[model samples]
Target: MVYIRRSNTRVVTERNLDFKEEFQKKLSIIEDGLKTYLPHEDEKPEIIHQAMRYSVSSGGKRIRPILAMATYEMFDRDVKYILPVACAIEYIHTYSLIHDDLPAMDNDDFRRGKPTSHRVFGEAIAILAGDALLTHAFNVIYESALTYSERMKLYVLAGKEIAEACDSKGLVGGQVIDINSVSIIDTSEKLMDMDIRKTGCLIRASVVAGAIIGGAGSSDILYLNTFGEKLGLAFQVQDDILDYKENEIFPDKPTYTSILGIEGAREYVKKLSKDAIDSLNIFGDKAAFLRNLTMSLIDRKA
Candidate 1:
């Protein structure tokens, strides 16, 4: 759905022709980029390549990369420059999912309606697939940076952002905390911290890396960073709420709804969602597509 801002009021509009067309066009570009960046399944070490393709090509909303593209577009229309990095972000996200579903992790049998990587390729292959994607993500960024020799520093900074997000103090750290927790997360501070590190870091990397490549100034970068953090947390909270609504919440796991209760969780989502949208004011009408995308995400059923 599209979100239009009228002076002093923000209105929600159904996803109409204009918004759909624009969003679809961008999505098409991102899909094509992912295909081009990924290795061919027939390449050497075909098993690992096949597993990577299988996991990444599985049906899912390509939100992270799309966020990067949209954020980049806010400053520069030439999205080609950012496409590689955007796809790399997806590769990293896909890698995380592969690992998350491993036998040692969540041990799920399916992902995005398809058999999980381990289920399809066996555990060893699945682990290697995740490892390959994680390492390849950096190579994609590096190759893209080489192509854009003049903007090497910007690319370096973008790569660093993604790297740190997935590193020990970020996504991995959060995962460790999640798997190691001996008791239910009873405090808002601890849960928020874990959620931000685990889920929000990569999202923050997506927006910040896009802005960096787009040559945004410090203030703009700060605003987009804030936007990403708030949006990421809101996204997770909403997911918790949905699980609760669907009777899928695990008693052993602590979610936003678990800690805050349903009504309180809903209220938190509203606050975070509003803050996320408000952070885009600096981009003015140029951010309409992003604003609408943000609204749609918060209200998504799945």
Candidate 2:
């Protein structure tokens, strides 16, 4: 199995300055892009609008949108053409977060250091907000596709895949399995399967959307999808590790680490990250930012 050892001896205290700087720069661009796409103040149903904005503006990594933008930049530098779709990806991600934090789901009271959507807004409004954002994401993609220079068939493909990835068979299904697993005796294989569906599906969609919009060929798309799959797995493993570590220090929820053990989870993340980076070798020098981003994902603290 592919694996890379952590360069930092202390996982909790370590910070890579270069990775942080690059992530922040990309995050700023993504934030600006999202702001440009948000509904204007005059839009109807002000509470729903406010909740949607509140959910998105809660300050996470913005990794999905950045992945879309960076993947697009790999083959094309025209940021203007891709910004709408990037924002759409962010909208979908934020919607998932909002739903995931509900009392019926993860029941998370805080997200990205702030009150979750359900905590600030009532659960009914939070649910409506998530639904609205998910639907609005499609609208953004359709409108943005109209502005493309060549009437891209690939954009159409990306749009279809994005819809598929967010549906019952994708992230939502994965979430269902995750919630069910909490009460049952979950196996390692089961957890991995659930993670790939829940988290890996969107991650795959982000990379594929970037490749499609960037005009990458079939081979490039396949390689990037492989990279994204591995990255998604690594991301989940890292989350497990963090969850386990946090539970040790303070009150927290359950995680794969609670099931798999901390060392095993860390090792799993290392293996996934290695495979993710290995997948990029197929692109030669064309995927430098993608490669760097994969490495940064493994090394990231938050």
Candidate 3:
């Protein structure tokens, strides 16, 4: 006998939305929740908390958190229930950015076009603030799992993916390779492997965690992960393409554009974005926002 594959995803509503309008609405909600969830600047150990807030409140697109929420909302409309977990994604992303911009890492002087955390807060406080955000992410996940979830397994699954996404072999490992690559020659495979871990892991985790937490069945989880993976790779490739368009290079380390050339890189991004959108076809029209989001990710400027 033969069997046909199917999507186990569900829909909470059928209202059509202008993609930009929906994105802004969801982004606003995420921003408000993130502010309320973070430590107050005037709290004890004020400078650390201030640094945390400064980075957290910076002009980010809130894409990761919104991706989580959007994926979750596909199966259920309980945004309140998932708000904390979603915030955890933002915290995790922010922590990565803070540390990535430290004097020892990317050694950047800015983030979101503003002074980097280390530039304003000093290195010691910057490091500590990153630590604080990193530690707090787990707490938010654990608390949200216990407090708002009917099925602890859902949050457990989400937490597991989020944690693994930050593992030495995942996000951190990618960063390590990047920093160490200045003197090393790289192949296309090596570059892709590193980028997938460094930049793609969290983006993949965002959607996978969201889809699983949103009540997708086992098959749906697999397909959604595929969607996340494709979308994530496309995002990185597009970033490289954008950089190449400006300066024809990414400073150091290898980029997809460096390996594939400009047109090849654009083709690569286009194919991945199409594949990502096609992955959503399994869920029918319920995944409209996700499809729109995947396409938009490649074209974003900041």
Candidate 4:
């Protein structure tokens, strides 16, 4: 049970200068950690290396890896043991985003404010790039096992967890629901189920993987799992809010707001964000970053 003393001072407002500085600092650490942990190209595999680098370095919020590092730090664990797992989590996530943006999927032309993989690389290469990232994520975890014997077991377990989350039982299954539901007119319950498997699963894995790598006890891990589950739902709800906002800007864009109504969607996101913060109470102040990040998700415009 790791804990930090609660401050007597009020919660720092997001507009505070210190909050922006701390957020940027965390983002820098995450970016550097990702670059350091990514595979180095030798002379032999130029194309694969190029695709991997292109997909990963395209720039988005490195939220998954940052969450992993934050959880590891909360428990006073060595960052080294968690770095590989954090990188792997990001790889898996990036792969999903790549595939999600493909022609047969969401058919998006832009992601993270740039051309999507398929749009730039052709569909075949984009598919292969996603496949490579997915498989290479496992490779990273396996390679780490060779060096850290004591941490090897946890790494293996985290790898297995990731596999489960990315497979039919997790993200893919949720995606299947999302595709099928596109024309069906979504109900609240159906949307919840779809988002849980599609987006929530990986977010849940990100937090749990951090706990596993940090060697947290069963109780702590359980609490973290709960936290992740709630956070995951909150994240998707925030995405829904963003979708609605976009629809307002461009009336032609498809959006949840069209289906749920703006006020209803906003209320739903609010409820999810509250639930997410409530789950962090078990971790006390040790979960400060997680708590703040969850709130940030709810408040974000993009």
TM-score winner among the candidates?
A: 1
Tell me the TM-score of each prediction against the true structure. Answer: 0.94, 0.88, 0.91, 0.88
Clashes of 2: 0
Candidate 4 lDDT tens digits, 41-129: 45346666666777899998788887877887777556778788888888989999899999898899998788988888789888988
Show the lowest summed lDDT stretch of 10 residues, model 2: 1-10
Candidate 1 structure quality by residue, lDDT tens digits, 1-302 = 55553443333334445666788897899889888998999998899999999988895788899899889988888988999999999999999999999879888998888899999999999999999999999999999889999989999999999999999999999888888653846777788888898899999899999999999999999999999999989989989888885443436768887778888899999999999999999888888887888888888999
**Two-way lDDT contest, 2 vs 4, winner:** 2
**Per-residue lDDT of 170 in model 3:** 96
Clash totals, every prediction? 0, 0, 0, 0
Ranking by lDDT: 1, 3, 2, 4
Top-down TM-score ranking? 1, 3, 2, 4
**Model 2 pairs whose backbones collide:** none
- Candidate number that wins on TM-score, 3 or 4: 3
Count residue pairs with overlapping backbones in model 4.
Answer: 0
Full-model lDDT for every candidate: 0.88, 0.81, 0.84, 0.77
Q: Where is model 2 more than 4 Å wrong at Cα?
A: 1-22, 246-254
Report the C-alpha lDDT of model 3 over 1-302, residue by residue, as the tens digit. Answer: 00112242222122223677788988988899889888889999999999999999887878888889888888888788678888999999999999999978888998778999999989999899999999998988888777865868898989999999999999999999988875563666788888889988999999988887778888888888898888888888988887785446545767877777888889988899989888888888778788878767777765
